[model samples]
Target: MKNILNNVVSLIVVMIVLLLIIPLSPFFLDVMIILNIAVSLIILLVSMNIKEALEFSIFPSLLLITTLYRIGINISSTRSILSNSGTAGQVIQSMGDFVLQGNVVVGVIIFLIIVLVQFLVITKGAERVAEVAARFTLDAMPGKQMAIDADLGSGLITEDEAKERRYKIQKEADFYGSMDGATKIVKGDATMSLIITAVNFLGGCVIGMVQGTMGFTEVLQVYSIATIGDGLVSQIPALLISTATGMIVTRAVAEDSLNIDVTRQFGAQPKAIMIAGGVLAILIAIPGMPKFQLAVIALTMMLGGWYLLRRMEEFSRVPEPAMAPGGGMSPTDIEQMQMEDEENFKDINSVYDLLSVEPIEMEFGYSLIPLVDEASGGRMIDRIVIFRRQYAQEMGLVIPSIRLRDSSSLNTNQYVIKIKGEEVAKGEILVDYYLALEPPNLEKEIDGIDTIEPAYGIPSKWITVDKKEMAEIYGYTVIDPLSVMLTHLSETVKKHAHELLNRPEVVRLVENMKRQAPELVEELIPQLISYGNFQKILTNLLKEGIPIKDMETIMETIVDSSMTVRDLDSITENIRVALKRTITRKFCEGNSMRVVTLDAELEKTIITSLTNGDHGVYLALSPEVMQGVITQMTEEVRKFQELGQVPIILTSQVVRVHFYRLVEQFFPDVFVLSFNEISNNIQIQAVGNIAV
Candidate 1:
């Protein structure tokens, strides 16, 4: 039944077009004219009631159909008038008589004025707005798409929601583009109305004079009335539709219809209404004004203003609900409300809610909430998005979404970063100040609160906003509090990225890899190295800050060595050697790889402490020797820091793991490399030696 009705609407549209060639009787012409007026009225109402432009997305096509219908009506009526001796439909004839009131000149002028308004003002303005809208929507598509993808990647929106939003954006672009062309149709329709009206008047006069039915003056009066009437009847509906088009294109999206929005906005301020009433009262008292009429209007205005003010006062005076005896509510109302509240709480805050924890979490003090509040212009979320992409590109790791929340128990300036539900790092940042690091060549020290850079522990000071420029001019590195926190979070995530990669992520990686190199993954998985061991190797590499983006190389190395190397550590070491060029480039500065080599005696001592067992290699050195080694290594590391270089310790392949195990607890930032991990093509610059 619905389809049949839709087909009927389609048939009617076709018939409207065919009416341009087929002549119709006066009664049929009248009915079609009324139908055209009804449609224009409906369009105007719908346009006004829509909450958004897309709600009436088919309006552009409807505009074309309605314009054609109006033109066809005009053509049929003009034919009846010229051929049937100015005897057209009563609707057009009545409209002409009522508008002219026996004055042909006045009616003609009014008809032309309506056409001019529709063409020059409404249609033209709508066209320009649609053109601009279409252009901007097209231009912003790329950025909008990126934002949607970012939201999807961050898990802020589900895949289905993202797809729907993308489709809506494309639909909006297409709608506006169509409207840009639809406005031209309206302009042409208005232009044609003028031509048709002129032809009706002139041609009717010629026919009447040739038939010798009336004098020149009589012919002029009769035909002018008919022509002006026909033009007015058609132009009135055209004008309404043109107005609707303007309204739809220019309408801003709101929660309510046009009428409701207008009312709410205009009545929001009772004081303004009262002021208007006072002005109306003053105008009513003016001597030259119509005293009775002005007085009545002033009284109505004053009454409306008083009503609004009283309502506002009453609303403001509404008291909060009072508690019953014992600081509780009454048994009936309070108990029911309490029960509902408990049920709602249980629904959301159940044991199931505690089962999941974000891989990375950031808890900030209450005062730092503004840093993540988008409404307050906080860009921390955007910065995090950028950080994720940067991490993916540089480190070849997909960091999970960092859950941000506020903690009132924390101090006003403190923030804590957590990995897998355990706190790993904490820092304090002054929200309104900038941290300025002093350069070595600084002539004088700036006066501020001395502190350490949160990310790197470099000595710094928190300076006020006014001193930022002076600090920069003095070659001090200045950073805002948000950037400081972001940098710290990014570095922390990179350092602990291995813990974030679990079996599921590894499986996903494998599935993705299979798409590119099916044969390699198919042969290696479950045949050479199990999936568990594969994940272990990747995690081991990430633990040492090696990018696994070169998956082909990693897989090839594993497939080649896993047959003989069953020990996971030995396999990892072998893979590291396979990636010698990559590791060398990472640690090297240009052609020279500056490093600190362990002393021969210390290396031998560490090697002697190593024990091979069922689990893996173990290091067991005396506490005194370990302490002495840590002290010596700390001194060598400081020298590299003073030279503004990252410290890299080199050792023989056999003792590299043992030495790394011993020193990592003391200096986590130091890079320890085995001799086999360095490429022969690079120059080795031994800056210092770690001796004990």
Candidate 2:
């Protein structure tokens, strides 16, 4: 029985096709016709009850099968009717006699009307709707996927949720696209029903007359009723299915079934119902109008409307306020809410909530809240999400969720970005103004308040909306206030990203890499280096802006280096050389890299100053020599800035690490690379030589 049930659908489909070729008895034909109507009704109800279209993803295939079954039943009924002398079965005979009531012309006209309505009206509209829906769904897929990605990157959704949403999107597209073509099948079925009905009537008339078995008038009455009955039996179910097609295609993202939604929506409008009742009552004054009937309907509508209005008012009313002794209303909602909040805070377990800190946070002044509020048309959050996705793709680091809040302690235009709990960067943004950065070669001057760009410390001005275009025309880079704040936030996060790579994040990275290179992780982790040392190596690389996306190479380099050296710095340096291709792609513009190099004398001094200690390595240079080296390094870096290039200091492998640590505080933005860390295909040009 279970095996038969499992293959029931296939068995039924083959039977339906066989029914088309085999002759059916009247009783069996009636059973198939009734089942066709039942199946169509079930489809209709299911389509109406579904809240989303994907819930009925199999609807298109079901529609094709039902349509084929209906066609098969029509063929069988037509055979029974023609062969049995204008008699199919009890079902059709009963419907014919009931609808005709001895009027053949009227019954035939009604049958034609039903077929036309199904064909030209419902089926036509459903087909068009399905076509348009399929087109729009396909076009919007890329944008929807991007939104899911953005939400995932910003920590709004988990990976599993993203995959589920993407799967639903694809399923929805497939369903709609199938529906677009399936609707045409419904249209053809309606047409076929009409053609079969015509053939039955005309063929019966010709056969009865030629055989001289019945007169012309008798043939018309008998054949016309049987034809109308067969058509009605088939067309009724087709109409129901057609309406269902329209319903599913036109359905939006609804929260409830169609019946509930329609009821709730209609009940929400009492005024319209009352107005309609009034109009009906006024219509009773017309001549020859049915006054008594109109009065009953109008009174019913008016009373129902009044009852609905009272219920709506009762639900919407606020609680009565208690009176104070001073003739004032007792504590307002805000005060009540505050009291409730204080009551909750009294719980001992709630104290732990106060001690927890977000990994990344941004607090803005009250005036700047609009920049982060999506309801106010601000896209700062969206911009930040896009940056998060782009950064993760490029840097192989997932940034923690950045919390945003409004603070009353700060100035009205100021916003502060914090890592863990301490403030790292702060800036001001004028809500109604744009920040225009001054170009080095200015063509003209624009009127605005002078300021500095927070992200890069470039000279800029806060200009009103009216001056934005002019400022752009004058060779100034103009940005909105929200964008200004977003840039400041992005740069701040990038600068402190290394500090944000905590233990939990490192574990997640290792687990992610383990999926791709399981052996590498198993051999290197806890075997050659512990998790803490692995994190330290990654942090050291990130501190200098090197991407750890190629985790396999990093782990392989670590494993090889662990054989010779136990120092984390040495392992990191080896990994850097292994990631030379990624570094070259990031910093170098083309085959040739223009950089600043240390003089041979300065390089020798730096190598000599490097001393090995328990902490791995350190540079022990005198303050006098350090000061001279900084001054000369500063001058050489300035030359790169003049030429509009990032300051890169290329040195030998031994001096690169210690030299970067020596000048890191003064030149945090500068890039320090060893000759071995650069790819051999790229040519190096020494634009300036730093010497002490």
lDDT of 2 by residue, 6-41 (tens): 999999999999989999988898898888889889
Candidate 1, 1-692: lDDT as tens digits:
98988799699888988999999999999999998899999999998999888999999989989998998999899999999888898998898889989988888888889899999999899889888888988997876776787798777899899999999999988998998899999989989998999999999999999985789998998898899989988998999999999888877457778888888876667777777767877886667888787767777777787888888788789676767788877687777889998997788667578788779999999888889887787879878888898888877778888899999889989999999999999999899999998786777778789999988888899999999998898889999999999999998999899999989888878888999999999998989988899999999899888888888889998888877878877777888898898898888888888889988998888878888787888998898988888888888898888888888999988787667767888888888899899988888989888775
User: How many times do residue backbones clash in model 1?
Assistant: 0
lDDT of each: 0.87, 0.89
| Quality of model 1 by C-alpha lDDT | 0.87
Model 2, C-alpha of 327: deviation from truth (Å): 7.2
Candidate 2: Cα lDDT at 40: 87
Q: For candidate 2, what is the TM-score?
A: 0.83
Best by lDDT: 2
> What's the C-alpha lDDT at position 200 in model 1?
98
